[model samples]
Target: MGSCIICGTDVGSGRVCDSHQEDVVFDFRGDSPNGLVPSRFYRGVVDGYAEFGVFVDLVPGVTGLLHRSELDRRLDTLDWEPGDEVFVQVKGVRDNGNVDLGWSIRQAEREFRGVLVQEPAGEHRPDEEPSDDGDDGDTEAETETDESADDDIEVADSVGDGESVDSVGDGESADGDAVEADADPEPTDKDVATDNEESAEVDATLASDGDEDSAVAVNGESDGAADEEVDTDADEETDADRERAPITTLGDAIGESIRIEGEVVGVRQTGGPTVFEVSDETGAVDVAAFVEPGVRAYPDVEVGDAVRVDGEVESHRGDVQVESDGLVLLDGEAAEAVRRRIAEALTDEARPEGLQPLGGDETVAALADDLLDAAEAVRRAVLESRPIVVRHPATADGYVAGAAVERAVLPLIRDEHAKSDAEYHYFTRRPLDEPVYGMDAATNDATRMLQDRDRHDEKLPLFLLVGAGSTTESADGIDLLSVYGVDAVVVDAAVADPETRDAVDTLVSPELADVDGDEGLSTGALVASLASAINDEVRPDLRHLPGASYWTDAPDRYVDLARDAGYDAERVAELREAVALEAYYQSYQDKRELIADLLFSDGGNLAAHVSEQFREKLETEIETADANVATEAVDGVEFALLDTDGYTHRYDFPPTPLLLDDLHRRHADGEPFATVGVGTDELYVRTTADVSVRDVAARAAEIAPTADIDTAGVREGKIEFLSGERDAVEDAVVAAVAEAF
Candidate 1:
């Protein structure tokens, strides 16, 4: 029989009783998995990791699986590496010679009251049992006497010169009194307790002292106190007696302790730790702190607060991060110092110098100031770790514009963040069906951002409207984003409404630069220049996009630029046709990879294959419409009208607007002419005259008093009318076109 080490209960075999098993730790000495006892705490070494669990070797050749489901925290958050010693409970030994382990909160040897060795022969006490003076009779008393004597010597050494032994306790011999050498030197209980109390007081005094003199002694200053002071001052010990390390230098300090001071730009809570993204003057890094599994660390700290983080630098999945030991919110001079440094750095880094437009387009050159402002905003967002969401129309020109900015900004995102997947998290492209940023798009963006803020504590994203959102029709959408304090920038080549200039935070448009609205400038050209300003490293990749955006009459400079970039006229045309055809099918989806392959990659076969489909579909639609064309002459102008519902595929490729554009180009014959493709409830007007769709719709409304007529798409020259008044609307539109020409 054996007595339990904790409660003194008698047991039949082992040192601990069944009720006291948890109070002790067991060392497994068996050679096989079958030798492990169930429900006993055993020490193990980490073997390796798997997706579902971790393997721990309980003995030299016996391993057990510590399933992730049995862990108290996330498996990824476990700092245990291979060969690291850990603690677990042997849950059971299976029939197939496998062992299952459970989580043990007590991981250290000192946390258990006693330890035992479990061998295949039987359970037995370890060689070194815990000392219990009360149970050891006279042998323990002799050991206590020796310890008391040692304590007396320590107390005497702590006393200063000329201080009497009485200062330690009343039990000591009095000053000027002599002790006989033959007298018993054994200490009484009172004397031993007094010595222990005095030793504790001296140890605590040395520990809490922070003065230079006290630090010298604590650091083993027997060599010389002056030399220790010199080394300490050189280190410039700050709070907690440690030197601060800059965040930018953390990459070299991995596996070493460091201190960093910065402003908290973002705070995210993961399944196991709270991650704070701290941005210093040089760069930003993620600092992780855990109070418990899934609990928030440093609840008092928030975004924009200046903080000092003391932690060890570690590499988590190839990204540099810090495991925090302490996080303190700064205030007063400390906070202001960090804030001032960050502000100066941001201002200097955000501004781009030497603004140069691509292809040397005069219109874009004239808008240099506005384009620079937009570029700065994008760069600043990347530095501050704010996400950038690009919204553009799903057209060939719009895709070209959005992709140009995307290629430039993605490389910058990769450089700024340490995570390999930062580009995916920090940049997004969302395509709109129409060339307008209406309420639906704004509401969707707002809801997603708000959810991200509440769940992940992410900063609100900056919205960049490319080739869209430059009309009074999009004002409401821009206002919705403004209501949430989200900044918006608009870059377009369309005839922008003057009200839109005031609606967005930054506006880059040709109209703003006093260029005529009909200057044949495509959005792709303007944004390509803006992309160059944002990231000059990617300027070479954007050389061909501007020319590929135009279906016809591309700017001469852009064409030469594309040719210089090795894309000839045939290749440029193929790329334009391919993008236009793909943009129509998934009118709302951003096919980033597919579009990049067609426009930027060396995928000649892909562009040629898609262009062939585009040509076949366009040619088929034009031939079918031409057979049913009706011609009429009015006031020296020839007007051709086709009933789009009867002559074309109503719901297939080559939509009504595109069909009319191709048909008008084929049969105009250099005369004063217009082609009108009339649908059931809408009609598109294509004319050689400089006439606006709004004017034609207004003139038609005046001619047919009972019909509802209005311009649906000003850019496409589309007018909508009541289905019952299709004939009247078409006749009035033709008359308006002849009168204007």
Candidate 2:
């Protein structure tokens, strides 16, 4: 009978017992189907897709079929493409040598408990414990198969990658070899050899036979004396070992004894141990501290406290974990040193050098300093490990800007935090229906932040208002965050009121530079520039975003920039339409992965495919609206009106605003045209003339005192008043327009 490689239990033949077969993965080195291990997870690459299922390559010359019947969801919804790395389970090898694959929910490597290197049967067991006495320490006693033996292995240090050896056996060692039961009372770090091997062996023999006093009678010494000697030696070794354990990243520190310094992000108590999720900037890992079962260890520690820990790295159910032996909370000088180290690491990577505006507008160019400040705020939030909340208008332009920041910030968050899901927790992009940060949006944000702080102990998020918070209309919303001292940054292309300037901590606007006319830039263009300042590596990716925001008469310089980035007018338009359509569906969800693919992936042709559907649906709606256009002359000012309730598909694709935008583009031919599409109780107005809806609403309210006219949307150039006084409001609005002309 052979001993199990993992737990040193008596097994019939194979290296691993039945209990551990599923928990471990073996790198199959043999050439034939006979060498394969069934019911184990294997790293695979997505080779291609077929009508039946996806083909995954587990190794070179070995492919498996992930049958559709085993899928948890529909195959078409899979975000995976050809050549992406994925994980699958090996179901079985058929008689014909074809491997059947089962679906593994985990797609990333960080999802596994622990990795074990399994060699062929003929190879030497790398984990075989060596004895200083030059004797093979395999005793004649029956090997224990107690699963609880794993809990007996005491590990105090963690560092490095997957185990090159095997799991521990009996109580000899934790990894492969560290302590030996029969070696000595004071074992060295390598072989755990005792100077008095004869006496130690006698004690081990009596202990194994379940003797009471016989175990303590060895070496003619008392039990207390032996225990004292063992404890003293172990303490001295551990003290010296702490100084030599090198600092490394969590990803690189798996399965090795090492040291780590980080801030405790969270803490949870399992039935037997308290797990502290620690983040050291390079990554995060859970450090488990165990004193007793069902008891809290390190009760003085709280979330956000800096700590220095020494532990043996291990993986627990796919997550990298540390079995901590020493955990010290830092305070005063030590704590300040950790904070300073993190800060230095964060600020060392400077923003792109000598960044410039994507367009030729001097006004936008002059706001470069303010843009730099805004980018710095974002970078600071990430470095400090604070969550960032981005708010943008629910329009094509707003989405473009929000997406640009998201693209730049996500990679930074990933680099700054070790957890794979850090981006989801650290950064969020939320879309607002209106281009105004009204009290409703602000109240929602405040409520969630307060709850997160109270329950989860989360830091107050950095509010990034892109394309939506630059007007006095959003003062109440911005003021809400200020009440709690939450820092906010505003980046908008439109001119903001003086009152709005005081609400935010930092505001970046082209109008602040006193540029002439409104033709200088789009909000998306400005945000793309700011995003470049935040992360320069993504500058090339953001070049087309600016041009995509402009629907008509986009500046020549911006268009040329897009062309230089390999996107011509047609490609730019396609991207804009694709983003708009995606924004319309699941408008609440950020759709982060999907949007990233549509924007950053070079070969997917996702934009072209989605754009085709967008144009077909949009053109159909526009054609219908055009056929129903009602023309009138209000005070000799040409007006184009469409009863959207009667002409447009209210609940379908090509939403009313997009349909109206297309209608205005189709009808405004070299004339000052104002197009109004009136829906149920609301309306949208688009004009080729230089008309301010805010000014028009103010003037129209005076023309008709009871109309209650106000600018419903500054970006859409829309006016909202009492629906019951539609005729009066429209007439006053028309008269106001005529007076301006």
Candidate 3:
């Protein structure tokens, strides 16, 4: 009458069949508490306590508080992980068993909580022999733990995941992860029939009875021929049913570059570790493997189902791993997905240095910082004269950005083209829109406006754009040159991304629009008296001008001249210094001569070289001169002069008033404020109160009543107005004067 959990048979009531009362179960880990906080799992973690110790349950409703004490041992270090499985046995009781469970791990190796396996009896009947499978054929086992699969042993034809290492009872089929704990069927007739009703127990003295060749003698006498054949067949089937261990060396899976084919034995979730046991034609190993992102970026293989990994294998910590350089996918859908993964991985590699991507763990603000910095840098560089030719562009943020680049860059270019005065000065490779460039526009337009450059005497740049594409791209806006109209369009030369910022940048090209118009001069009554200038007035003649350089050189040259004079003093004292100074100047003069000669001769090679060398030298000299100028005093007027309204004088003096007399002389006599009234022969002093004596009073704008300022408008007194309308002029001037004050 023994019905116990250990053997699942009836034992006589009251006494435990297999229990040893002397051993105490000390490891009484109960179910974990309701508040047990489990940490999220990931790779590379050492299972640290990023949190407090949690209570892990071993039995229902009873939790054991996992503490550092769990690692108490002679080793002195708690290096083992909570997930690592170890077997320990209970040896004795502790502290009167009052909640303190002390156990001896050394005594209970097989008696601990694990699969309880029943051992075969010592004695057997005369004809009894266990079946070949060593256990019931239908019985299956499942694992609650993992095993090292590196260089894992592969079955001759195949292998399954999580197979048990040791055989259980006879006739037991191979164990696998799919071997449900309940996969074993109820007592089959085979098992029931094998357990004889003839299993009559004798007295205790008879327990040691049956032994020695009784089975051989009984079978040999009854069926000698038949028994021999049966034994042979049984032996072969038993051999086939034997299970192989599943751990092996990583080296066996790989060698140079041959493909290893096997059916897919494992399929981890995508984006997770790719694991499977691959077998060769004969045997195989369970491989623990992964592809690095660089390999992932360009992977050419399918995983999971079936794969032939044509890669190198390596041993990482005695674990076998497939070191794949690349993969080839045999399946259709899997192949596409692998390619996409590779593409994604590749794109990640191409991100600019120092730019970080948005990892899942990153905060929103951090991502914002990256994006903001990229946009601002590009924008700031372009405006600050140190623009860079970067692939990534500023966002389509139409904020108030500063650039002297014209508000109407297209119309201005068109007008310049009509007058045959447009000349695009090329500044290739470097980015800066300086005064010499005629227009303050992006080099994006420099190409298209090439045809308009006054190449009659000047050589224009023949830009050969280079980049990732084949043929010239369609010139959206940037032309080749003003004179050349548009240079060749090159596509793929510029990197394209899904971001539309490049689109915004491309817009810069079209700002150099086609201009074909007639020449017209500005003419008006007020302009007629001034310098017989263009439009017959005091207007500036700037149509054919090369921009501010024409105006700035007069000032810059004086500084250069002063430099020579200062250096001349030093040179005069030392002949060596004089020679060196002379040589430098002569070299510069010679280089300038070369450039001039090249320009005049139109010698392609000589001109390009001299131009390049001159620019380089000029830039260096300019920088050195700047350092020197930092110490020099500017030549602002000393005792300047006065602008007199014929009566009063206002003196203009240098910023530094080193000499006071220089200021006094400027206000002396009518030499400074001489005024004799023209109409009234009266000599009056011009003071702030003498409104009548002011020049603007004498030139109080007079206009036709028939024509309104609206009809012929311009700015007045720093405001815009037209001579025909008095009211408009008064309003505009009043506004301007108020603003100026």
lDDT per prediction? Answer: 0.76, 0.69, 0.24
lDDT of 2 by residue, 1-741 (tens): 554444455666544667756544455545565566889777778899997899987776788899888886557546567787777788999999999999875443433332444444432133443334432334444234222232243222221122111222334443546343232222223211111211121111111112222112112121221211222344435543554232335556677877777777766654345677776645556677654333456677778887777678875545567777557666666567666776676676534454576655566667777888888889888876788999998778889999999988998887766555668778988898778889999999999888767755678899999988888778888888899999999998975776777778998876665656455578998899888889988888888888999888888888999889888998888888888899888776677777777766745389999989998888788888888999997765678888888998887888787788878887778677778877645667777777777777789899988967777667767677787888787778777776666
On residues 552-642, what C-alpha lDDT tens digit does candidate 3 reach at each position? 1212322333234332222211221122222233221212222223222332444344335534443443333223221111122111222
Query: Lowest lDDT 10-mer window, candidate 3?
Result: 393-402
Per-residue accuracy of model 1 over 1-741 as CA lDDT, tens digit each? 444544444566555678767656788888888888789889889999998999999888999999999997657557678998888998999999899999986665544545677766555557544334313222445434433453342321222323233232322343634322223445432101122222221211111113432122222111111111222332234334766677778888999978888889888865345789898887788887653334466676788888777678988656788876556667667678888988888899888895788888888888889999999999999988899999998888989999999999998887777666677778989998778888999999999899888877789999999978887768888999999999999998876878887789999888666864338899998999999999999999999999998878998999999999999999999998899888888777778778889988856999999999999999998888899999999999998889998999877888677788889988888889899988889998998878877778899999987789987767777788899998898889988888888
Give the TM-score comparing model 3 with the true structure, all chains together: 0.17
- Which model scores highest in lDDT? 1
Which regions of candidate 1 are displaced past 4 Å? 1-246, 516-518, 646-651
TM-score of 1: 0.69
All candidates' TM-scores? 0.69, 0.69, 0.17
Off by over 4 Å in 3: 1-53, 57-63, 69-93, 96-169, 172-741
Report the number of clashing residue pairs per model.
0, 13, 70
The worst-scoring run of ten residues by lDDT in candidate 2 lies at 200-209
lDDT of 3 at 277: 39
